[model samples]
Target: MTSRVLYLFGSAAPPVHDIAAVVRTAQNRGFTVCLGLTPTATDWLDPQRTELERLTGYPVRSRYKRPGTADVWPKADVIAFAPATFNSINAWALGITQNFVVGVVAEGIGKGIPMVTMPCVNAAYAAHPQLDRSIETLRGAGIRVLYGEGGFVPNAPGQGRPPAYPWHLLLDAAEQAASTP
Candidate 1:
């Protein structure tokens, strides 16, 4: 069976370093991966777009197509939102689909496709009143949110650096969520 995993990139510190590893790891685990990046995330990965497309055998989409145009990617069996940032997390929870990545994820949730989210916010950001509620809302929608122990935890702001991103954990959580009934 072919498991098509749509990996959505958010503007966070981790994916900038771990995207390649994430793709390779998922592929090794029998997933056919496609990439969708937030506009800012796409800017960060712009130089590697061609290489990343080559790696996944699918184009990296960061923008919506013209109204009459067709989608360039295959139907996704699972959606993985890695390095999900504070802004993206809130935007997604509020059903704001201004960007391609969030739009796809929102629609996927409505369709009841298996979905996973690995947030990469700092402690200050996480403390925002809306953040916790947003997470709870997403979890209520059946999204497997990878947070706290064994997943992502907040760091101190202005640290100027981050610990190793848990890319493997993101894929692992996604795989488990996808296997759920």
Candidate 2:
């Protein structure tokens, strides 16, 4: 069988710092990984950008390409938008595609790709009423969202432990998505 490509998108949350390790783990599971980041995440990881490309064997994309330009990454077999920020989660649900990460997911929904998202938001931001609506919307669309009890529970503001983000559960969900037929 051909390799399964996992398109991993991230936002500017602290867990975004652990993406390199996540990519490595994804690769070990036989996924040909492609990485996309929010603009702020791109800047935050600028120093490791080159190394990330080396690790994934694909450019780390943060913005849209020119209209006539070809897409460099393979077609995604599964998508994981982990470490999703409050803004990205809402934007994606609302079809706000100003950025590449949100744009891909917005379109990805109609393309029938299995997608998963786990927010890295804090308790303070999680309290916003819109967040629950957004999560339901995505889940209503068949996207497997890892939040609340079974998944990520928002930590108190200023108390986030980025290193402890549930990378394993996210990966497991992605693996399941790829295998579901």
Candidate 3:
């Protein structure tokens, strides 16, 4: 296919609410966007499920399909997992594939799928030390993690979400990953 497929996964973070806009932005950048979400994120966006499926031209899948079910989304050329939550990140890094989103990304590592992840976490969670280890683990596995300096910086709890979540940086890294061959 000439157009690369972008598997965009979001967690339960607040920024996931802006996914429709992000899908449009990714489309404008020439990706065929396919959106997936953590189970709670899917519940959070249930009302917009139809619209999101329409927006991305694919089913919004959270739960794993039954055995023998065919995969619906196109083969992903690159994955941009942004607004990943503390729980999702930790679970993903630890190889806990309880959720569909984390399962794909966990397998994406071995599938040779180029991937980018930007965590949307609070300062309290970011300071837990496990977050740092998880980020390093992902990086060691060739996944570009947009955390700490030059990427996403955690905000203080109760301070509200950051106005900008560095979507550009994450998308830029995704673009680069797809082109690396």
Candidate 4:
């Protein structure tokens, strides 16, 4: 069976070209992509979601209510949250399934599937006590949390891209997870 990789989107700033690149790279690596979109993410890349679906030939879900409606929901093997916003992170940490991304993540955790979350928020939010607690909670639960490198640096001229350490590390983790028995 083809290994599945679900991509969850969070509320990041506009222009998610970096995310698009990551998704495209994963797709090229032969992983099926299931996109779960946080509502706020729609503001940055509305049509791109549909475009991603077209490119991957997989379903892109924006809400939890529409899952399994596409006939491929139960086949997921891994779940990854990239560019995870503080709101979505807090909600996931608290078991709040207010949207498709959190709902899928909750299900993945219940099933004991490997999960990876890349948090992309401002430094202040990343340093918040609640955020730390949430990260600890996720770590205790065996979820790999890839904190933004060198603090919360939004996509800027030289800093907005994925951190050098975390990106390859997460990719390696994903490869191992996909190859697992």
Per-residue lDDT for 1-181 in model 1, tens only?
7665666455545555568667888888888888888888888888888988999988888888889888777777788888888888999999998898889888888798889888888889988999999999999998888888888877888652444667778788777776777
**Candidate 1's error at 46, in angstroms?**
0.9
- Give the candidates in order of TM-score, highest first: 2, 3, 1, 4
- Supply candidate 4's per-residue lDDT for 63: 61
Better of 3 and 4 by lDDT: 3
Where model 3 places Cα greater than 4 Å from the true spot, the runs are none
**All-Cα superposition RMSD per candidate:** 1.7, 0.7, 1.1, 3.6
Q: Give per-residue CA lDDT, model 3, range 37-101, as digits (tens).
A: 99899999999999999998899989888999898888999999988999989998999999999
lDDT of model 4 at residue 173? 59
lDDT of each: 0.81, 0.95, 0.92, 0.66
Which tens-of-lDDT digit does each residue in 80-164 have in candidate 4? 7766777878888999988877877877787888887777666656567898888788878888787745323444333444433
- In terms of lDDT, which candidate is strongest? 2
TM-scores of all candidate predictions against the true structure = 0.92, 0.98, 0.97, 0.80
- Error of model 2, residue 148, in angstroms: 1.0
Candidate 2 wrong stretches, greater than 4 Å: none
Superposition TM-score, candidate 1 onto the true structure? 0.92
- Model 3 scores a C-alpha lDDT of 0.92
Look at candidate 1 and tell me the lDDT of residue 116. 88
Write down the TM-score for model 4. 0.80
